[model samples]
Target: MIEESGRVVSIEEGAVWVETLRRSTCSACSANAGCGQGLMEKLGVGQRRGYVRALTDLQLAVGDGVVIGIREDLLLRSSLQVYLLPLLGLFAGAMLAQWLALPEAFVILLALGGFFAVWWRVRGCSRRGVDDPAMQPVVLRAQLAVCAMPVEDR
Candidate 1:
């Protein structure tokens, strides 16, 4: 399970909206100095909060902290759907155009068309998966609040 800690932002009938900080490891990469991605991270390009509607049975309040998780297999499948599908579409389109002996410009255009078509299909699938319990993250448990007071004060 891939787990993340987040704070509950809102409550619904059977779920809670949790807000988590989107974290990256770009700073730890050895190529950070020469990587455009590392520079982009330095510029805060992808730093943002992520909101997830996690299904939960625990009684949660808006300020409560919780740990949420999704299955590793689900994450892997989603990754493949987002990345491999488009590449396959592009290759298929290019192969078909080449086999037909189409002009170079037409081949590029057809490839792009195929890529966009598959991307559109993937977007639709993601939308439909929004309500799928198997795809959605689940609240694993609520985080216990730490006491701010010193032990001597007790």
Candidate 2:
């Protein structure tokens, strides 16, 4: 499971809005200084705050802290869906256009058409609830003080 802790910014209809600090991998690497990512970081673009919505079982309220997790399998599937589908669509369109000996402009348009088609298909699937459950992040545990107290200490 991939997990992150965030403060509960709001709670509504069984969903919790969590605000978390976003960190970049560039900061940890030695080559950060010369890289684009590092340059952005140096320009005060690092450590931005981001928010996520998590489906929760616990009764949570605003100002609460919580831990949320995405299952590994779900994460993998989502990653593939978001990244691979577009690439596949672009390649397929390019290949078909090439086979037809289409003009350069037409080829570019076809490629973009393929990419957008896949994007639209994915959106339709999302609306149809094909991957809804797997895509949603789950609230793993409430970060209440009581829960954090060790048994021995308690």
Candidate 3:
């Protein structure tokens, strides 16, 4: 499971809206110099806020800290669907156009058409998955709070 800590911002019937700060480890990575992500981070694109609607049965309130998670398999499947499927469609369309001895303009047009078609299919699939429990993030647990000693106690 991929987990992230966030603060609950709101509550719904069966869900909690959590706000999280996005963090990056690119600075600590040895390949930061060679990574495009690192470059993006250097350009001040790393830190940002994100909101997630996570399913939970626990009684939580606004400002309560919690941990939320999603399955690794689900994440992997989504990544492939978002990135690889359209790429495959593009290659398939280009190859088919070439096989048929189509003109350059036709090949480009078919490739773009294939990419958009697969993208549209992916959008539909994502919309349907929104209602699937397996696709939703689950609240793992409440975040632990730390206690500090007062000046008098210390």
Q: Which stretches in model 1 have alpha-carbon errors above 4 Å?
A: 33-36, 39-45, 151-154
At residue 29, give the lDDT of candidate 1.
96
Cα-based lDDT for every prediction? 0.94, 0.85, 0.95
**For model 1, how does the per-residue alpha-carbon lDDT over 16-97 read when each residue is reduced to its tens digit?**
9999998789989999999998998999997899999999999999999999999999999999999999999998888889
Across 45-138, the per-residue lDDT of candidate 2 in tens digits comes to 7778999988887888898889999899977877787789988998889888988999988889899989989988877876776437667888
Of 2 and 3, the candidate ranking higher by lDDT? 3
Q: Which lDDT value does model 3 have at 3?
A: 96
Among all candidates shown, the one with the greatest lDDT: 3
RMSD of 3: 2.1
Runs off by more than 4 Å, candidate 3: 33-45, 151-154
Per-residue lDDT of candidate 3, residues 58-98 (tens digit): 99999999999999999999999999999999998899999
Model 2 accuracy (lDDT, Cα): 0.85
Query: Cα deviation in Å at residue 40, candidate 2?
Result: 2.7
Give all TM-scores, in the order shown.
Answer: 0.88, 0.82, 0.90
Q: What TM-score does model 1 achieve against the real structure?
A: 0.88
